[model samples]
Target: MKRYPIRAAKYAVYLIILFFILFALLRAFGSASPMSVLWTTSRGLMFLGVVVVFALLYPFFGFTRKRLTFNAAERADDVERIMAMCGFKRIGSENRPADDMLFEAASTAKKVAMMWEDQVRITTDADGVSFIEGNRKEVVRAAFRMGTYIA
Candidate 1:
């Protein structure tokens, strides 16, 4: 939950900028009066606030953790491919700290959409138990892919 505030603040900044642009466009091209545009923009911002709050909060409270176990016969390459197919890119070697493979959303647009909290860390122990950690929705999606692909 500690990360929520930072995410919210960042999103708020973006939303404010978006609303300002909308206001300007409506006033200039839509022939809307300044006060009307201001009112509409304010309402739009409020609606966005509600939506963004729910989006950011749901992962913390509403999602279940997902995990996968890969036997010795399973290759990490296959796992990487599934992750890539699911829109993840492996973190570069220089930053990887352990046997753990770190991944983030493959595209800048996705990173921004996820508010940059789209990391999915997979660390397999000697027993082949791989723990998945990060934003819940992405983890669940990746786990589902890995499960189906590796099965």
Candidate 2:
């Protein structure tokens, strides 16, 4: 899986909001001693760290991986073009154990928006069955477009 180091601007704004919310909650329900400030800050930082980790992992665990099987007569090139129409650009192909074609978001901004899950890997078997593994929305969109035009 390829990683997009830069994230969308909205995510940074969201994280800032989350940090403030965590700090406010900690201050409200915390102890009322002089050292409570330090304690609350530490606890809020820890909680924020956990939330950030969960947000980072959400893309990997939250999406469903689906396979779209095309007819034997449909050419791989046609499928590649459909994927392009669906907002993915073919990076290249590799002769792995299975026939694999790799694709990424069409533009740099789209790639940043997708973050870590921008690349979609399509594996075509000898029987013309191709499995598209990526974010569920992207996979489904590509599958739907291919089905509409090719079927």
Instruction: Tell me the whole-model lDDT of each prediction, alpha carbons only.
Output: 0.72, 0.66
Lowest summed lDDT over 10 consecutive residues: which window, candidate 1?
64-73
- 1-151: candidate 2 lDDT, tens digit per residue: 2432233233444566766676677668883334344337886567657656765765555455566756413466787788888888777555433367788899888876665458777777787776777877888888788778876
Model 1 off-target regions past 4 Å? Answer: 31-64, 69-74, 92-99, 125-128
lDDT (Cα, tens digit) per residue for candidate 1, span 1-151: 5666776566566766776787689778976566554447876557666757765765566334555766412466887888899899888746654458888899999998877877777877777767777877788888888888885
Give the number of the best model, judged by TM-score: 1
Question: Clashing residue pairs in candidate 2, if any?
Answer: none
Error of 2 at 103 (Å): 0.7
